[model samples]
Target: MLFQVGGQGTRPTFFEMSAAQQLPSSVRAALTYSLGVFALRRPFIHKILDYEDEFFALLMLVLETHSLRTTDASFSESLYGLRRRGAKIKLKKSNLLTNSADEVRHTGLRKRQKVLSVVFLVVLPYLKSKLQSTYNREREANLQASLWGDSDERFDGDFVTGDNNSFGSRDVSNIEASARDRCIKRVRKIVGACYPWLHAGNEGLSFAYQLLYLLDATGFYSLGLHALGIHVCRATGQELMDTSSRISKIRSRERERLRGSPWLKALQGGLLSCAYAVLDYAQTGLIAAVFFFKMMEWWYQSAEERMSAPTVYPPPPPPPPPKVAKEGIPLPPDRTLCPLCLQKRANPSVMAVSGFVFCYTCVFKYTNQYKRCPVTLMPASVDQIRRLFHDV
Candidate 1:
C-alpha cells in the first residue's frame, strides 16, 4: 500500500508506489479516455450552449416576425461553440433556432437571464456612447499623427500639441480684427461680381447657391428634401412680389426702348425666334426653366399682349377627378385569401378601374416595381396613398 503525505513547504505530496510502480498500457489508456469525457462536460461549456440557444431563438423570432424563413440544421451549426479572441459572440447561428418545448427551466437560470436582460437594457446604450468616444479619440489621434510627424516619444502619432506652430493664429483679437477687415473687402467684391445676376433676378443661379449652402450645412443624403424645400421657400408672397416688380420694370423699359428702335427689334426678332436656341441658355429647376422659356418667347412681343394673356396664377393646379366607374360598370371584386401570407379578405380600395379588387397594401407593394395596376394598366399614386372609392 502507498502512504499519502502532506507538506507545509513548496512541494506537493505525490502518491508513492511499491516496487511494481507503473500501470499497464491498457489501464492508462482507459484513464485518459475517462479524463477526456469529464473535461468535456465542464459547467462553462454547457453554460455557453444554454445562453446561445436562448439568444438564437430570440433572433429567429425577430427575423421570422419580419417575414424571414429558415431551416433548423443551419441554425444548429451556428450555435456550436467556436472560441474567438477572448470575448465570446453572444449568439451562435444554431442558437438562433429552437421550439417552445426545447426551453429548459431553472430558478438560477431565470435569475441569470434577468441579470443579462438588465445588462443589455441598462448598459448597452452607454456602451455605444463609450465606443463612440473611443472611436473619436482614435480618429483625432490619427489626424494629429497625419498632420505632424510623430514625436520622438511617438512624435508622428496622436498628440495634444505639435512641434510646428505654422498653422496657429497670432491671437484671437488680432485674427478677428483682420478677419473683419477682409470680410468687408470680400463682401464689396462679391456684391460687384453678383450685380448682374442680382439685378437680373436670376432666380435659378440664386437657388443653386442656396441649395449648395444647405448641402454644406446638413449632408448629401438630405439633398432631396432640401432641393424640394427650395420651391416652397421662394414661393412666398414677398419673394413673388419682388420678382414680379423686377420683371414688370424690365419689360416696361424694353417696350419703351423698342418703340424707338423698331428696326433693331425686327433684327433681334429674326435671330431670337429660334425657340431651341433661346432655350439653350435656360436656367435650372423645372419651374425656372418653364418661366425662362415663357420669358424668351414673350420678350419681343407687345407688353399689352403679355398683360392681356389669361394668367394661370396663384390657384394651384387641380388633380384629375377619380374614375366614376363609367355609368353602367360592374366592379368584379375577387373575394379570396392571399395564398402567400394567408391573409383573408380582398381590399376594395384598390379596385382596378377594370374591376379586380385586391388588398390595397398588396396591390401597391407589387405595383411599385411592376408599375402596372394589378387589375389594369391604370396609374397609381406613390405616396402613402389612401384610397377613396365611391360606389357607382
Candidate 2:
C-alpha cells in the first residue's frame, strides 16, 4: 500500500526514503556530540557548543528553503530522488454529457503550504528542545528547594518582612507583597500540575507516530507532512533529470538568452553559470563525503564478526630502568607515627596533594586553616584529606 499507480513511477522503498529524511539530522547530532566531547576542556568552546541546536536549525532552514524553492523538494528529499507534493481532492460536478469521477491530484506544494512545512520542520524542533531544557532546569531547582526547604524559608521571609512605614505607605506595601506572593504561588502550582502531563503527552505522541511510521502508512513519515496533506513521492522519469544534463541545459539556455550581448557580458554570464554548476557539484560531493566518513566510522567502531578479522595488539610497556646502587643507606620514615601529630596514628588520613600521612583530625584542621600540607607546605584544601583504611 506504500505505492499505487496513477502514473507509472519508480517508488522508493519506505526505509530508503526514511533513511534519507533522517540522514541530515543524524549528521547534525553526531557532529554536535563529537564537538562537545572535543571541547569539554575549553570553557569558551563549550559555551559556543551550547547553541549547537540553534545553529543547526538555522542551517537546515536555509538548506530546506532553497531546495524547496528551486527543486520542489527539501534537501534530503532532493538527494533521495523524492519531492513534496500537495494532495488535492477534486470533486467533479455531476454532468449529463460525460461522467467524471472524483480523483486526487498531486502537484508541487503551494506557497502557504511550503511556508508552514518549513516552520514546522525548523521552528517546532528548536522550540521543543528549548522547552525541554527549561523543564529540566526548573525541575532541578524545585528538587533542590524541596530537599533543603529553601523555598519555604524564602516564601516566609517575603511574606513576613514588610516595608517600613517611613519608606512606603502601609496599604501599598501590603498590596505589593500580597501580589508577589500570589504570583509566585500561582506559578509554582501551574508548573507542578502541567509539566508532568506535558512531558507524558509529548512522549506518548512521539511513540505513537513512530509506531505508525514503522507500519509504512502513506503520508505519515513526518507529522508535519501528514498534517499539511503533503506527500513525498518518487520523481517520475521526465521530472527527474541528471545534474549534469540540467547544468548543460541551463548553459545552453543562458547562451541563447545572452547571444545578443557583448562578448564581455557573455563571458561574465558564462563564468557565473560555471560557478553555479561547480557549487551544485560541491554540495553533492560534500553530502557523499559525509556519508562515506560516517560509514567508515561505524565500520571501525563495530565489533569484529569473523574470527579472521585483524586484531591489533597494543605495544608492550617498556622495561623499567635498571636499579642503581647507592653509596649510603637512608633510614625509612617511622610507619607507626603520624607526621603532624607525632604520635601513634589514630584515624589516619593522607593529603592528596603531598601524599603524606597524618592523623585525620590533625590533617583536616591543618588543611582547613592553612589550606596547605602540614609537612610539605604545598597548597591544598580540606577536600584533599582522604582517610586511609590501613593503620600507619
Candidate 3:
C-alpha cells in the first residue's frame, strides 16, 4: 500500500534519476566524508565526523525544505532535471447504487505529504544509518562475549541484581525472578538468531524496490518518496534557477541605485556579490572539484603502481668488444701477449677507454703520466687500469 505505481504524468527514467538524483547525492556524501577522513586525527574534527550523519541530515533537511517550499523539488532535482509531485489517487465507483465511472485527481503534494516527504528524505536515512551502526556494534560485542566467555557481563543489565543478605527474601525473589529470567533469555536468543535474517531481509527488499524502480514499475526512485505518495517527473523548464537569477540581477541593480554609508554600502556590495557569484557558478565549481579529486586519485594510483612495479637495470655494458691492439701499434703475433709490454700478460690490466691490454704496473705508470692508452693514444686514466687475475 505504501508503494504505488502510475503517476498522473510520465515518470523520469532510471537513468535520469541516477544522473540527477543518485550521482549528485553520492558525490556530496563522498566529498563530506572525505573531508572528515582527512581531518579525523584532530579530536574536535573526529567528534564532528562521529555525528556526520546527523549534521548531514540537518543540513539537507534545511536545504530540501527550502527547495521544496520554493520550487517543489530538492536541490539536486532542480539542479539536474527532475521535480517531485504528489501521486494521483484514483477513485473507483461501485455500480450497486448507480453506474458511476472512475475519477482521478490532479492535486499536487498536500501540506502533510510535503512534510512527510521532507522528513523521509532527510531524517529517515540518518536514523537508518544509526540503527545499522548500533546493531553492528552490538552484534560484534555479543560475538566477543560469546568467544571469550564474558556473556554474564554482557547480559548483566537483562537480569535483576538481588541483595546477598536475607536468605528467605532471596529464596522468594529467586522463585519470582526465575520466570522473568527465562523469558528474557529466550527473547534475547530469539532476537540474536533473527538479527542476521532481518538484515538480509531488509537488503533483499531494498534490492527489489530498486529493481522495480529501474523497470519503471514504481513512480518513485526510492521507498521514501513512494511511501510519502510523491512522484518524480522529468522537469520541463520550470526550474527556479532562472527565477533566482532574474531576482539576483534585479537586486544587484537596486543595490547599485540605493544610497547608504559609503563604507557600509561597499561591504554589503562585496558580500552580496560573492554570494551571487557562488550561486551562479556552484554547478561548475562542483564539476571542477570532482575533476580535481579524480586527477588526485589517478596520480596516487599511478604512484602506487610505480612503487609496486619491479625495477630493471640495463644489462652490464657488453664486455667492451673484446679489446684489440691498435692497427698502427706493432704487436707480437700471439694475441695473448700484452700490446704495451710485448710479453705474455702478467697481472694483466686493460685501459677502458681504448681496446688494449698491458701489465697493471705498465698501464698504471703510462696512464698516470700521459692519461692515455699507450697503444691507442686515446685518453684514459690510472683508475681505468683495472687489474685482471690469471685464470690459468
Clashes of each: 13, 0, 0
Error of 1 at 295 (Å): 24
> Candidate 3 residues 1-392, lDDT tens each?
01122234456656656665564455565566466657856657776676777767776776677666655776567665566778676656465357444343434667887788687777766766766666666678678877886766656773445755645667778787988977866765666566678779867876777789978565557767767767776555444465466566776686888568999889888887776566546546555655666677788899999999988978886665544346535666887887667888888876777756677877787788887777767777787766666522
Worst 10-residue lDDT window for candidate 2 reads: 322-331
Runs in model 3 deviating more than 4 A are 1-10, 36-44, 91-106, 151-199, 238-291, 310-392
Ranking by TM-score: 3, 2, 1
Q: Model 2, residue 49: what's the lDDT?
A: 81
- What CA root-mean-square deviation does each model show from the true structure? 44.7, 13.8, 17.2
The lDDT leader among the candidates is 2
Per-residue lDDT over 1-392 for candidate 1, one digit per residue giving the tens place of the 0 to 100 score: 11123333211112211101122122223333333345586745555443433443443333222211111101111112100011111344465666322222111113333333234323542443344444555556557768874444453465436654644555677689879967855654455455445435544644554455444332111222233221111022443355447545754565555533778887755554453233322212222433444464466466768788997779888766445333322224434643223455345344444344455677667567656444445655445334645422
Q: What is the TM-score of each candidate against the true structure?
A: 0.14, 0.52, 0.53
* lDDT minimum window of 10 residues, candidate 1: 78-87
| lDDT of model number 2 | 0.69
Query: What are the runs in model 2 whose C-alpha is more than 4 Å off?
Result: 1-11, 37-44, 91-102, 151-218, 242-392
Question: Can you write out model 2's per-residue Cα lDDT over 1-392, one digit (the tens) per residue?
Answer: 01222333544566756666676776675566556656877667776587887877887787777666666777777776677889886777765248665556887789998898788778887876766666676677778988886765766744435546554657787799989988966765666667779879877875676567667544456566778888777876566665336646766676676555598777878787776665566446546556666776677567445556778999999766323224211213786777666788899888787666788987888789888777656779988788899864
